[model samples]
Target: MDTPSSSARVCGERPFYDLHAEAYDLIINDPVKPWCDAVDAQLARSSSILDAGCGTGRHAAEMIARGHVVDLADAAPRLLAQAAARCPSARTQLIDICLLPTADHDAVMCRGVLNDMVSDGERAAAIASLARSLRAGGKLFLDVREAEASRERADGEPRTRSGFTSRTTWDNGLLRVRETYAMGGDVVEYQFTMRPWSVGSLTGLLRDNGLRNVSVGGGVGRRTPDRLFVVAF
Candidate 1:
C-alpha cells in the first residue's frame, strides 16, 4: 500500500477512488441482482441506458446482457477503465455526471453517486444534468443514503475487507469516512466526506429539476435499510 502525496490528499474524492479502484469491488461488494431486477421492472426492453457514475460497470454489464444499450460514464479514469473492460460493447466516457450529454439516453441509472456531492449547489447541478440527459418520457433511477439511517450506522467502527479497513462518523449533515489499506509493510490512508439526503429535500430537488411523477422506495438489494431508491420521469 502506497499513500497518496500531500497534493493528492487535498482532493479526497478523486484520490480515494484512485487508490481504491483496484479493490473497490471486493470492499464495497454488494449483490447487483436486485438492482437489475428493479431496472427490469421499470425500464422497457432494449432501452438505451446510461450508467452515470458507473463504478466498475457491474450494473451496466448486466443491463447489456439483458438486451439494453448501455453507456458507462465516470469521473474517475481508473474506474471508467475498469468498467470499459467489463463492458467492451458499451461506450465509455471519462466525464462527470454534471457534464453528461443532454437528451442522449432513454433512461439513466445513478447509484450511490449523489451522496458524494457534498454541497447543495453540486447536488442540484448533478440532478438537473441527469434530468437533461433523458429523452422525453425518459426515466431516472437513483439511490442515496437516508440521512437518519446513515447517521445511525456511522458508528466509526473499523471494519476490514479486502485488506482495507474503514471507519465512518456522522458530523452534523456530513459523513466523515476514513480508510486504510494494508499490504506488505505499507499502510495507506484516505479520507472523504459524504452528505446523506432527506426524503423531503431529495423529492423537492427532483421536482425542481423538471422530473415528475416521482416514486420513492426502500434501497435496492442489500441497501434497503440505509438507503432510499427513487425513480422519476
Candidate 2:
C-alpha cells in the first residue's frame, strides 16, 4: 500500500498501511497491546469485531484468541496473507477503507492509521461509514501521532530502511521487517498532517459523525496519546 507525498496537505489514495506489514506489526506490538487490552474491556468480548487495516493480522490474531468473530480488511494482498496465517479461521478480505460501510460490527479497530493519512473529505466520509456500520452503541478505536507532537519528534530527515513484506505458502502468522523511522521535530512537517488532538476535538468528530457516548482518554504503555475512542449506531 502507498500514502500521499510528504509535500501535500491532503493525502492521496496511498495504501501505505500494508507496505511493510511486518514493520507495522512491530510498531503495533510496542503501543497496541495496552490500548487494545483497554479496548477489549471497553467493548464486549465474544462479539463481532472489525479490524480495519489489519496488516499481517496482528490485531486479528489477538481478537480470535479473545473469541471475537473477526473480519479483517485491508488492501494489501501480502498483508492479507499474513493475516490469514495468523488467524486461519478469520474472515479476511482485501478491501479499501473508503469502499466499506459500517454497522456489521460490534466494534472496529484501526490503529496507527487514519489520522496520518486520509483526506479531510475522506476522513469525514469514513467516519460516517464507520458510524453507519456500528449497531447502536458500537465502538471504534483509532490511533495517530499528533502533528504538534510530530514536530517535537521530528528529526528533519525521513528515516528510510530496506525491508520487504513477503507472503509464504504456510498460512501462519510468521513475519519479519526492518523498521525505519521518519525524522521529525518541533519544526518538522508532513503532507498528510495531523495535530495534537485533545479528547474534545476527537469527541467532536465522533459526535459530528453521528456517534454518541464519545470518550476521550489517554493510553498506557506508550508516552503518546495514541488511542481515541468513539461509539455510535
Model 1 pairs whose backbones collide: none
> Ten residues in a row with the worst lDDT in model 2?
167-176
TM-score versus the correct structure, for each prediction = 0.91, 0.69
RMSD of each: 4.6, 10.0
Tens-digit lDDT string for candidate 1 (48-78): 9999988889999999999999999887778
Instruction: Quote the RMSD, in angstroms, for model 2.
Output: 10.0
Error of 2 at 203 (Å): 2.4
lDDT of 1 at 220: 85
Judging by TM-score against the true structure, name the best candidate. Answer: 1
lDDT of each: 0.82, 0.56
Compute the lDDT for candidate 1.
0.82
Model 2 segments beyond 4 Å from truth? 1-28, 157-201, 220-233
Q: Which ten residues in a row have the lowest lDDT in candidate 1?
A: 1-10
